[model samples]
Target: MTSLVTDTRVVFSRELRPVLRDPFTVIFSMIQPLFFLGLFAPLLPDSPDGGSPLQWFVPGIIVMSCLFGSSMTGSNLLYEMQTGSHERMLVTPLRRPALLIGRALKEIVPMIAQAALIVAVCIPFGFELHLAGALLGLVILAGFCIGLGALSYTLALASKNKEWMFWTVQQTLLFPLLLLAGVLLPIENGPGWLQALSRINPMTYVVDAERALFNGEVLARGTLEGLVAAVLVGLLGLAAGVRAMRRSD
Candidate 1:
């Protein structure tokens, strides 16, 4: 147990250091969320409680950030592949799963920072924060990112630095996942088929949980579903990521 933790920390540290040095890209990633907040949000109807759109939209945007950012992390591994850095690491004594876990762990910090910045940006625009709920919401967001990040690394390994393959799978899935989850728009009023699709999409659950958490509905059914979905994703990602790591190892 101790060794696994240590290994995870080492891997996490290695994954984190580069972003700590140059965070410009991290900030750049925020522009899209802000754009959605500024532009797309106004086109929506008010919250049921007569609140600003931020009440409903902010949490969704946070999840959106987690989704896109974690998914793109595979490209980093692809870069390591091209330079043979990844090959050299494979020669080290690190545990295989730790390699993947550590990289996935690195996703948390930047995501939290971006979430904080987004909240700060939204506050001046009349977005209210539900402290306890927001914190829990972040927990949900982190779980989703860790799982997704691991799968992304697995994809990177599978692609063998073939940028086209990696991007193809990512682009094909992300927008569909994003839209189906109704992050920027409500699917409640959509066609029966669309709403049915949303029901099966786990991201729809997670997004609902974020909004529920943000609204301080701690005991909401969506919250339970979201947590389950995150755990399932993490487990699936770990299984696949570990297999990919072993193959590469």
Candidate 2:
């Protein structure tokens, strides 16, 4: 038990330090969502549902951060592949799953912090939160990050040139998530078929659950259905990523 904890901590520390040291890493991860909240929030039409645009948009912004950070996990895998770090680890006694878990653990803290900040900034813009749901929302968001990060890590292994191809392929992975999730607009406003499609989208589940939770809805009733779907998809994505990585090796 002690060794497991120590191993996770060491890997977590290693993963986190580089992210903290790089200024661009932090800025680029955060800048787009902040820009969306600042510029686009006001442009959204007011709700007859009796809430501000900030209420709806803030959850989406939080989701956007998850979207970006989760995608960036590929970059870490790319670095490992380029530097032969992954190969070195392959020779180590450390459990492979532990390495991935530690990597996911490290990535999630920053994502959660960014999500909290989005909520804080949105307060003036009229975002509300039920304490219980906010807490659960954070968990759901972190779970999404972990699943996506794992997937990205696996994808990076298949990428022949991780650096050059990382950004290009990441855009492809991210756009579908953002569009189907209704980050910038409501899914209901779309066509009936589109709305049905959005329901199955895991990202949309988080966005909808969090948005409802942000409106101070009860944690149990408002979120249970969506949360279940999010958890399932997240687990499936992570499992697929792990399988891909082992196959690549």
Q: Which candidate wins on TM-score?
A: 1
Please provide, for model 2 over 1-249, each residue's C-alpha lDDT reduced to its tens digit, 9 standing for 90 to 100. Answer: 557677768778888997778735765787888988889887888778766777778878888988887778778778787788877886777666667767767768788778777788878767776677777787777777887787777667778465667677788768777888899987777999888877777888788877777666755553876577667756876677656655654
lDDT by residue (85-150, candidate 1, tens digit) is 888988988888898899988888888998998899889978888999989988988888888998
CA lDDT for candidate 1: 0.87
Q: How many clashes show up per model?
A: 0, 0
Each candidate's TM vs. the true structure?
0.95, 0.88
At residue 96, what lDDT does model 2 achieve? 62
10 residues in a row with least lDDT, candidate 2: 213-222
Compare the candidates by lDDT and give the number of the best one: 1
